[model samples]
Target: MQRGFFVSGVASTMAENRLDNITHNLANVNSTGYKASRSSFKTVLADSHLAGNQKQTSSASYLSMGSQYIDTSAGSIRQTGNALDFAIVADGYFQVQQANGNIALTRAGNFSRDGEGNLITQSGFPVLDDGGSPITLPDGEVSGTNDGMIYVNNQPVVQLGLVTLINKNDIQQAAGTLITTPESNTESAVGTVVVEHGALESSNVNAVLAMTEMVATLRAYESTMKVVEQYNQLASQLNSDVGKIQG
Candidate 1:
């Protein structure tokens, strides 16, 4: 295969993936407690040998996506005036029980109650307390302190589960508002994990920046495509002129 074809293909692929990533972030700009992701990469050989050719050019190496990491920085907190909604003021995640009896971490605080008065997230997952158990609120007015302690009728009911990742990079953005939390990667809250009741955290995505980057990526992809077209044209000409000529 032509070296330009290989290079162009890899380049265009990188741009396409980058565009998809930016689009996802922009789509969730209004999502509560949503954290944006940024791409990182490293150079790697696309193919060591191709079409029985043993020698390859230095240009065969291309930039490959090494990994993606969330921004992790806290988003702006918006006051919802709803008692059940809460926002984390800093680095920590709220624990919610999934249908599989496993826990998923999230920063979204738009919580409500299930039929049994169990505190639940918007997706209907029961919220966990500090002791790693589902919290069931009694019938009464509920309130919370900055330290994550919940109260009903002036009596403490339970403390919310607020935890921090031992290494922030260990987690990944999962389906809709949930984060892939590894149990071993998490630890009890360290430092002051402030909680703001009656509010929710806004997504950290910057719409303007994302749109600008999308435009740039699209241009890059187009340029790479043009290069690939040129290579194809050259191949056709070679087949017509060189491959057909006989001495």
Candidate 2:
């Protein structure tokens, strides 16, 4: 009888966590270069038979293992027609120097030059070059090629620094559209990533799908609550019946 209530409690907790994740995804549905996250679960069997020599008997339970973001999927690319706007055509990331001097990776190519003529992201982070140094562009008509080659006044200036992660799990959100991974797990993506100037990458989140998930999760949570309530009533009745028999 108690095992039934335990299962219902676990279910309720899991549903709450799932709802939080869905809500977060919906909020970032329109964010540029945003990635959606999902929760993962696992089951643990507490049966005595499975435990062999365990002293206590317990029932099976579900566990919320945690969550991870979907990073490999590419979002839709749209033409912005802005000279500084850029988008990656394949698997790669742009390297940028954060305000704290730490390096981070991002798919957002929407860039602009700062007052010092240094190429930077919309958030004012300096864009890096192949040498891991901030790129300083000369004042002129600037253009970028699919190969990440930057040109000023028809003269080739510097190529954008692009890289890839050996393991996506090593990455963590640093700021708006910016992610950072362990430096040891990164490698040069010279040929893997193609850059498109005058374009931007949209968020990968699907609004319709997220809404559907939210509805389903809410229903599941309600169902679990009902189960919990039923178990509580059954427990109360059982206690009352036992007292009557004693009397």
lDDT of 2: 0.84
Q: Give the per-residue lDDT of model 2 (tens digit) for 66-162.
A: 5555555789999999888889886889999988899998888888998889999888889999889999998999888898988999899998999
What RMSD does model 1 have? Answer: 2.8
Report the lDDT tens digits of candidate 1 across residue range 1-247.
5666777887888888888889999999999999998888889875555357567544456787677788899889989888899999978999989899989999999999887899998888989998899999998998989988889998999999989998888887876789986799998772369999999999999999999999999999999889888889988998888866952
Model 2 residue 101 distance off true place after TM-score fit, in angstroms: 2.3
Cα miss at 123, model 1 (Å)?
0.8
C-alpha lDDT of candidate 1 relative to the true structure: 0.87
The candidate that wins on lDDT is 1
lDDT (0 to 1) per candidate: 0.87, 0.84
Candidate 2: segments with Cα more than 4 A from true spot: 48-63, 236-247
**For model 2, what is the error of residue 7's alpha carbon versus the real structure, in angstroms, after optimal superposition?**
2.2
Per-residue error at 30 for model 1, in Å? 0.5
